[model samples]
Target: MSKIDQFMSGRLRERKDKLSIRNLSTNILPVDFCSNDYLGFARSGELKHLINTNLASMPDYLNGAGGSRLLSGNTKFTEETEQFIAGFHLAESGLIFNSGYDANVGLLSSVPQRGDTIITDELIHASIIDGCRLSHATRFKFHHNDINDLEDKLKLSKGNIFVVVESVYSMDGDMAPLIAISNICERYQANLIVDEAHATGVFGANGRGLINQLKLTDRVFARIITFGKALGVHGAIVLGSKNLRHYLINFARSFIYTTAAPIHNVAAVRSAYQYLNKIDHQLIHQKIALFRNTLKEQNINAIDSESTIQGILFSSNEAAKLAAAHLQSKGFDVRAILSPTVALGKERLRICLHTFNTDEEIISLVNHLQELN
Candidate 1:
């Protein structure tokens, strides 16, 4: 066989004969057990109207940011968005990025200078790991959420240390110990960077995120908040001090090189924030409670998670795919997170709950899982 064909064959063989891959676009309209639109803002007609209203308020707010932010891409809208997000997040300033993945890559790659030490949780998102790989810092991973392990590592670190973690872990649907991690960072005089991707629009009084809800906004060096998951839009912001913002503008390669996001996309994200800023955050809390309550009642031991992500662990990849397929057939769109995404033997059916989901739908989905179990 040709070299290219041989490479593909090796990948297939490495899948261990347990590759439970599926065909694309199997759009089964089931109860939403797989989307990250936790607050229903993705489908909000009100948010859509707000986008139109804002543009109507400024008819000149045109189509695109044409180039990079430092070049032709920077517009009045960019400054306005930064100011709005800064106020909302209670940061000294906010720097917007094309997306959370870009923000993580840029922040991790740029912030950790040569000779600096970067400590990250073992189960951090792939984007962060990739960014860390690109950084010049000596990198290390602590046991997930184990503060003692983090403290031990920090003690040996010799340079400017940066600790990185996510507020709500996406794959496992667990949380980093923000309070404990913050304490450890403080003890070591290290700057903490928190990625609030999965926490936005689900935590805090106005869904500002876990740090804001806990009143720990002032404790971190930077926070990466995504508009995609909970806010249900496209991009993210790095909330930090004005100096950090300025430094990122000058040094963050990803932000400096890429063309800015389209103005309409930016405005839609702003609209989601505006709508969320006025909604009943307690309602989102109630939905999370209801979903978890039903998951428990049905005896599907969804791993401990208070956020939108919940995992139904399976024995193997095939079992995970089968379980997820069963959920789909029963009118739910749960997804199987397989090996490599998670460890072997820990494959899971990742259930994503949403505020739009009714108690009946949550109950029905869990009951179906119960039958399968």
Candidate 2:
């Protein structure tokens, strides 16, 4: 066997021993408590119809972007879509990337210089972490959502300071104290960058996002809004000053080097934004309340979350996996989030609620959770 193969096998065996090995499966179950389609937009027939209609209306639409946006891929339609989305979120301008990961990485990796400092929440998304790593900036992580801790970190930061956070944390599903954080950043003269990936289609008027809901858009230096989660499509956009848009176009390597997203994705994004105005976002909040109330009534402990992404903590990877298997066997599509994706003993069953989920489903899932607990 090759020496590299031996090393890879050893790593795989270690993951197996820890009960934390990862694999992909296509066997989706009947009930969906595992997906990120919080508003059912991904499966919405109306959304699909809107996308089709938009595509048909476009003249000579191409199946793919022939090159990077800087090359042959730039189009009037794509540029218009970016402007429309930015206007929806009340941003000065916007730039689209292939995905949320690309947007986060590109923005973080390029914006902060060697003397700069990047202070992030301890639980920021993996993509943001990767972006920070690629950057030449000094980095520090404060306690998750702890304003005091964030301030403490900010006091020690040098050069140009960038404060990064997510509006809604993915694993814990709790919100960052954006108002407090923004105030702190203003005092420190730090640039605040918010990842609105999970909040894009779940908050604000017409699903604008938590940042827009809080009316802190002007204070924030930059915001990354993704289309995949609640928007139920692909690609992402960085929203900020027109200069920041121009800066990313020239400097963000991930954006500058990669092929531009296809015209189809641009059309879908445009359609999704139009459809966003018509969605009943309050329905999702109702489901979140139902799930949390059920857990409380049954005396089952869960992570505190007002968002659709809910988590039930487990003591170990094996326990979380077993609970997920039990739910899967019962025909519910729930999954385990084991360490080191999260810290040890912070393993959990990540339950995602949706507007389309019935009260019966929520109750039944909570009952099953009670049994596990």
Candidate 3:
């Protein structure tokens, strides 16, 4: 056989050995217990219609971004969306990116220059780590969500410190100590950036983010919000000062080189925000409350979460796999979150709650998990 075949065969065996091979498939089961469409926006036919309608008005921007924004991609709609997003987050400005992953890599990699110090939470997304790898600054990781630990690290950090963290911990469904973290950043005169990927559409009264919930937006240097999660679309935006906005457009590689996201997608995001502002948001909150109550009733209560994500810790990867399979067997769509996604020995069954999930479905899934362990 060819060397390519030999490589593929060897990799297959390695996956079998480590249980690490990934394959994609669609298994339509019962009510979803495993998607990040927190407010049911992903499946909203109304929002889709809005996108289709508004798209016709922008025929000039159809097809592609044409080229990078620095070339010809930047358009009137891009500016409008950026203005709307920035104002929503109460930032001086906003920079659009293709996805949350891209925004993290683009900004983190470029902003912290050589001889500067960069500190991030241990539980930050892998994209941030990769960005740090490309950065010119020295990288350090503080213990997750512990402001005191972060302060201690910051105290020892060198020139031009930048502290990075998430408004919501994606894996654990818990929040960071934002007020305290901002204070620490303030005391040391360090800049702070918060990733609000999972907190959007579920935290602030206007579904702005956890920072708005805590009234801490102005205190931080930057905040990143993804449209794919609670907003239920694709792409992301970084909220910051106008100088930082201008800087990223001019210097951030991902923004400068990438084909600006299609104009239609940007329009869809604008529609999503419009729907958010007018909808009865409490409906999702009520659904999440029901989900948490069911978890407690089944004695499978999650650890330290106040958001829509409910994680049931299985501790061992094997056990988590078994639990996930059991949920699937019972006709649920939940999946096991294994290591390399989360740290080893902390694997879990991440149950994502949506606004439309029935109370009965929620109870059935939790009771099934409880019965497994």
Candidate 4:
């Protein structure tokens, strides 16, 4: 075997020994408690119809962007779409990237300099961590959602301090204390960057996100809005000042180097944003409340969440996996989230609730969880 092959095989074996090996599967079950389509937009024929209608109106619509935005890919339509999204979110300007990962990495890596400091929640997304690693900045992590800890970190930071957090955490589904965090950053003169990936289509008027809902947009230095999650499409956008937009255009390597997203993807994002305004977001919240109440009635313990993303903690990876298998066998699409995705003993069953999910499904899922617990 090649030396590289031997090295890769050794790492795979170690993952297997830890019961943390990862694999992709197309074997989706009948019911879905496992998707990020919180509002059923991904499966909505109406959204598909809107995208098609939008595409039909565009002249010379191509299947792919011929080059990077700085090259042959720049289009009036794409720029207009970005402006529309920015206006929708009440931001001064916006820049679209291929995905949420790209947006986070590009923005975080390029904005902070060598003498700067980036303070993030301990549970910030892996993409943000990668971005920070690529940066020349000093980095520190505060306890998740702990305002006091965040303030403490801020006090110790030097240079241009950038405070990063997610509006709604992916694994636990809890919200960051944005108001408090923002206030703290203001006091420290730190730049606040919020990842609204999970909050984009789940909060605010017309799904402007939690930051917008809380009227914190002006105070925040930047907000990353991802379309792949609740928006049920592909791509992402960083919303901030027009200066930040121009800065990313020139400096964010991930944005500057990659091929621009296809025109169709951009069209879909535009359509999703339009559809987002029409969705009755309260329905999803209702579903969340029902799930929480059912869990309470059934005496099932789950990570407290006011959002569509919910989790039931398991003591070990084996326990979480067994519980997931049991649910899958019962025809639900629930999956286990095992360490080191989460810390050891913090392994869980991540349950995503959608507007289309029926009360019966929520009750049944909770009852099954009750049995497992």
What are the TM-scores, per candidate, against the unseen true structure? 0.96, 0.99, 0.96, 0.99
Tens-digit per-residue lDDT, 144-206, candidate 4: 998988888988999999999999999999999999999999999999999999998889987
lDDT (tens digit, per residue) of candidate 3 on 1-373: 9999999999888776766567788677777988999888989999888888888787666687789888888888889899999998888899999999899999998899999999999999888889889999988898988888888888788888899998888888888888988988999999999999999998897799989989897898989999999888999998999999999988889888888888888999999998898678788788878778877777775776888877888777788888888889889999888876888888898888888888888777777877886
Candidate 4, pairs of clashing residues: none
Q: What does candidate 1's lDDT look like per residue over 1-373, in tens digits?
A: 9999999988777775668443468585657878898888888888889988977877776577788888888878768988898888888899999999999999999989889999999999999999999899999899999998999889888689999999999988788889888987998999999999998888876888899988889999999999989887899999999999999999899999999987888888778888987788888778778878877776668789888888888889988888888878877888899987899899998888887889888788778888876
Off by over 4 Å in 1: 20-23
RMSD of each: 1.6, 0.7, 1.6, 0.8
Candidate 2 clashes between residue pairs 3 or more apart in a chain or in different chains: none
Give a tens-digit lDDT track for model 2, residues 108-200. 999999999999999999999999999999999999999999999998999999999999999999999999999999999999999998898
For model 1 the TM-score comes to 0.96
Off by over 4 Å in 4: none
Which scores higher on TM-score, 1 or 4? 4
